[model samples]
Target: MSNATPPGWYPDASAPGTDRWWDGTAWTAHTRPAAQAPQAFGPPEPFTAASGDATTAARSGTRIAALAVAGLMVVGAAVTGAVLLGRDDDPARPEAGPSGSAPPSTTATATPSPDGSPAGNDPEVLVDQLNGITLPIPDGWEKPDRTVEPVPTMRTVDPYECPGSSSDFCYHATVTSRTASATDITSAEQLARQDITAAADRAYEKNIVGNRIHGGITSHDQLDSAPVSVAGRAGYQVRWRVNTAKGPGGYVQSLVFPSTVGSESLIIVRYAFDAGPDGPPLSLMDTLTKGIRPIGDSATSGGVGSSIAP
Candidate 1:
């Protein structure tokens, strides 16, 4: 007996129209006219192999074009990155510190102290000899006398004050010492007026040490103050201007000495040529005052002697 076919079997194209083929769960094969098949579906065209040379050429051209475009992009990115980095590294940019916006600090150099010596060449010493002394004599200024007889003293080689050519006034050094009580001592106001009159009275056509002029004690009231310390004694400096026969004159004289029982005050007088003109440098006065030292024990042991020269 022939084998029976199952339901849903269809004819197979490979076996021809009379033969049947088994279909699993559904019809697996079918045939239609060429026109009808075309209307519904068509056979795929055969794929032909391309020439190796043509294919390789086209692929190489595409790859080269892609690589060129990629290279330009990379170069552009690199250039941009370099430019940005350079700007960040520029030195002119503000630097960051612990205090977010603070700028860098700078150090300042210290100034040297002025030389404190009799001749401006010796190191300053803290001796008990002279205290709060000052002088303005130029370096190597001649000191005729260096020894202290009865008082700590300093003298300049050249007379600092001289009479002007147009006036009868003469320049001289006036040394005055008073052993009276502070009450007896002239007030600072009185002393200043006295100094100006003294300068005018002592004025001569030529400078002299002690040539006196005849005149009443007229007062030229002008006064200013400065801080001073002498031999551990605190005091103030008094300065003023006065008119003399020579013209308007300038003067700076200070009396700073210890005010104790035996303490003595010394006044070194400096007179200028005229107002508005350069006068004797006050530096000399500074040097003289700084060089002032107490007389040795032997000199002041029996109370300050009276050998002090004005």
Candidate 2:
């Protein structure tokens, strides 16, 4: 061999068997190839069964328990429905349910006659009777003038002056008579004013005209500026415009007291027509004023009290 060492040979640098051989450029001879551990094997011990069967049993039990609960709920609902139906069908109960307990049967009561007087058999006859009193019903108007006989002691007549005309449609002239006390007699003038004001309030549905009370008489007029008079009473003559099912017009009401008895009398004349171009007819007002008379003669005639009648 020549003096140069071989290119691939190298001395081992480890003790004995542990010595590593080198292949010149690196120590490749010292490295061992990696090996994987072998897996243990046998007749797979008893092939342990999956817990799937026990899990299925538990799941099936849960489903059955849920179904049982649902069934019990359905049964409870049916029981409640049956109980309700049974109660509804029970014969002991009246057709009305328990909440609608039957009221005690009561005998029908007859309506008592008004003012302890019998009702009129004939409305026309009643109207005629009413017309015979104080106020005269205008002719050519409806016959058997409307009568509201609420009480035997009270009668109200609605006499229209002219039913066809809207402008002058006057309601029935009314005459009311009733026994009253001395107090009623004492306050006749006040009552008259009150009645007039009430009527005007109803007619206009507005403020009462300014007025003055003089000589036991309270007089009301329009704005205290207009010139009007009633029954020579030296005041504005007030007219009330009234609208009704029959039509619309004006009403002139007067209150008078009986000369003999301490009682009250009322007269209402309804003038139906458009307010005349010259205003209400002086003739109508004159007639109405002149017509008011107390039941008895005047005090000058040796009567106990003075009559308001003309």
Counting clashing residue pairs in each candidate, in order, gives: 25, 17
Please give each candidate's TM-score.
Answer: 0.32, 0.29
Per-residue lDDT over 1-310 for candidate 2, one digit per residue giving the tens place of the 0 to 100 score: 1111111111222222122212212222221222233111100101112433322321221111011122345744743222122222222211111111110110012122322112322221112111112222223222222224332221223333343333332333333332222233334344444455554432323212322111111233332122233322232233444433323333444343322211113223222222334223435544544443222224323111122221
Model 1: per-residue lDDT, tens digit, 1-310?
A: 2111122112223333222211212222222111211111111111112332322321221111011122345744743222112222322221111111100111012111121122323212211221223322333222232332222222323443343342333323322222223334434434434444444443322234333332222344445555555434444445544444543444445443443221233333333223433344444344434433433324323222122222
Give the Cα error of residue 245 in candidate 2, in Å. 17
Deviating ranges (above 4 Å) for candidate 2: 1-133, 141-185, 202-252, 259-282, 293-310
Error of model 2, residue 107, in angstroms: 30
TM match of model 1 to true structure: 0.32
Among these predictions, the greatest TM-score belongs to 1
Candidate 1 residue spans exceeding 4 A from truth: 1-137, 145-183, 186-223, 259-278, 283-310
Model 1: how far residue 269 lies from native, Å: 6.9
Residue 196 displacement (Å), model 1? 6.1
* Top candidate when judged by lDDT against the true structure: 1
Overall local distance difference test of candidate 2:
0.27
